[model samples]
Target: MDTEKYVPGISVDSNGHPSEIGIEITPEAFKNLETDNSKTVPPDGETIVVPLQLKATELTPFDHIGLNWNPHGHEPAGVFDVPHFDIHFYMISAEEQLAIPAWSPETDAAFNNYPPIGYMPADYFTPPGPATAEPQMGKHWLPGNLGAYLPFSKIMIYGSYNGKFIFVEPMITLDYLLSDVDFSANYSQPEHFEKAGNYPTKYNIYHDAVSGNTYVTLSDFVARN
Candidate 1:
């Protein structure tokens, strides 16, 4: 967790271009911040580092931030910060799974579903600043809030390999990914999403097993009127 000893590794820019400077991280270090919930443990070897890019105007820099996907407009909780636009890739090997005591022939199917490499966007929202508010009466009703504080994107690859999350140094920018797109695009519009046959509840990146590629889709995170 001490980034002081971390070194730079191979990384890619937001456009998927290769770069030489990436922040290297170990599984032990990653576990300090994230858990192996999917249980896709990595093997013992040279740990790979993930790269992140910061906004030019951002005064402070952070390797990672918790994303607050508050689709229902409830009270916010935990430390959340806007994510950096770019993410880096990390790879896993089959030997690591073999090293685990729980390794079994039946587990091969699970491992096959995971990609050998993955990339998670650095973007997230910063904790809200303190603000006073008046209490509402029991009979008062409020309309749904449908705006994103910041652009959110994250990708978890399946293994063809996985580990703890490694949030590292800057590499690419978000603008590079959506290059040439009209600035008028509105992803936060609930009505617009419905017209397009999409739900505006919760948007996320999904991986296609047949195509070996990732795509984004909008679905309900809560009941929508």
Candidate 2:
């Protein structure tokens, strides 16, 4: 879309590893994120990522932010710091088939057996601050809503080789792909997350095709109860 390439699986080097978010989602990079099945691609290539997470100190330093799937600015990247609640992502591209309703609790509508992603419900409540009274990190899995995790959420992906969602090379890392959506690993304690205990969120996931990729950095992001 933006002329491709936005790698960031920790921007490794000097021995840390990862130089390009673990590249290798071939099949021409999942047929270049698709538009019309790119000729029924699948000599290998198919992915569906967006499995929420965050809590590596909530992230800071920025090449990109707000979605923790990293890589949004084309680079050997790494940055974070920004996320106090106000995340965004809705690229449901099966060439676009998301009317999501029939009892829209946030989906489980099953046109594709969903949940390759997480924490949605308008990202835990819409426009205002502290979205519906702060304290989030998980919830909403079946007509959802139980104080739905809090906010400080997560969801991004990097899968192909037939996994399911190839929305174009989206392997996450580097503070979950460029942190900082106003950030907060407790930014002045927004009630220090009221309910769902054990709060410590982190997320870095990537699983590619042509055979190359791996990273699931989420030590934890609790507060679920």
Candidate 3:
């Protein structure tokens, strides 16, 4: 059916309407993981633990706006730690964030080998825990697919102080996403990022919408104004 919902991971119109993409990814290529699929995209469910230590990197354009702009919403910027240099990305729920301790350089190297903070294979997905007791979830152990949304609404990154500077490659899906996820809801005309606050007007020329979630190199952002 034809509709005008905002799909996260997809770009949006100036009015926040979701733009259509040219390609499609069916179940053949993209797995529709139930709480119990062999691939276990999110093995547990609501909680997928990132294996790393992190320090707070400046909250990009969003930080400039206000971390709690939503009054009570997820922070778009992930935390980073200078000691360990690990990054924690995609932390949408507060529960997930509270699960781990602040980043520590000493733990960065061996934390992966310990339980409660062990690393799972990208394919070894698990929700926060085996199940959630939240009334919203009913009696299922998996997350309540209450709406047509993914497990997490935002993405974040946290890394130890010295592990590496390689950013987590963005994991984008050709599938649909929620409206709030598609656009920088907190961003307005002047507040939007100017590709690191520098560049020419033409370099900032953006399409009505974009094609992916990962950051595209803004060679244009560096152009002289």
TM-score of each: 0.18, 0.23, 0.23
RMSD of 3: 16.8
Total clashing pairs for each candidate:
21, 44, 41
User: Model 2, range 36-67, lDDT digits (tens) per residue?
Assistant: 33442221112222322222112311112122
Off by over 4 Å in 2: 1-32, 36-125, 128-200, 205-211, 214-217, 221-225
Order by lDDT, highest first: 2, 1, 3
Cα error of candidate 3 at position 6, Å: 22
Computed on alpha carbons, the lDDT of every model, listed in order, comes to 0.24, 0.25, 0.22
Candidate 3, residues 1-225, lDDT tens digits: the string is 011111112233474332321111122322233333344433322332222112111111111000110111221223110111111132223342334343345433322321222221122221332121111111111113323223433322221111111111112222222121333211011222213422211101112333422221112112111
The true-versus-predicted C-alpha distance at residue 127 of model 2, in Å, is 2.9
Cα distance off (Å), candidate 3, residue 120: 25
Any runs in candidate 3 off by more than 4 Å, and if so which? 1-27, 37-152, 158-163, 169-225
lDDT of 1 by residue, 78-112 (tens): 21122122222212122332233222345433322
For candidate 1, the lDDT comes to 0.24
- The number of residue pairs in model 1 that clash at the backbone is 21
Better of 2 and 3 by lDDT: 2
